[model samples]
Target: MTFENAVLKLVSGQINRVSQPATLRTEEKAVAGEAASQTPFSEEALFEYHLYTLENPATLKNNQAKQISLMSADSVPIEKKLIYDSSRNEINSIFHQFQSV
Candidate 1:
């Protein structure tokens, strides 16, 4: 193509980029505005998130060490008990190090 045609094509691309209208619908724009205006998580939502973390095996096992039933049921789903035991020991040691500090 001619140099003039190449220049025109570049100019057209720039205009297209600059003049493109926003694509969000009115409802979507409102939702986007609301999300921008509010905190991502309220205190209640944060607390619930924390409660969820507490329900996981890592937390439950740490908190219920004295309970025989919990100890028995605390086994991971892995078929290899040796690997599980080694990893559990390592995790417990790391946990203890953190607790000590």
Candidate 2:
């Protein structure tokens, strides 16, 4: 192969890093389909999410995280100004940190 062809193959290979899919039994198919919706999250986030689940679990699990975030947005109540204050404080802290350096 020419140098260009070899370099092209190497770059293409790096783009496809996902592993092969697992072959599952018929019974496992249902469970895998049901569980596939869960996203990668920190352990703390998972624990907190499950804690909420214990009180009231979502009817459907096979959906994106946005579904859950939206569910929380509808269910959980908070003062908008309070949220704004915390966000402002965070931005100000970042700004000060940069200014100091």
Query: Best candidate, TM-score-wise?
Result: 1
What does candidate 1's lDDT look like per residue over 23-75, in tens digits?
97665565545544442222223322321111222223333442212112122
Q: Please list the Cα RMSD from the true structure of every candidate, rounded to 1 decimal place.
A: 27.1, 20.9
lDDT per model, in order? 0.30, 0.30
**Candidate no. 2 TM-score:** 0.18
Name model 1 segments beyond 4 Å from true.
Answer: 1-19, 39-101
Report the lDDT tens digits of candidate 2 across residue range 19-50.
97567766445444444434222122332232
Q: Which ten residues in a row have the lowest lDDT in candidate 1?
A: 4-13
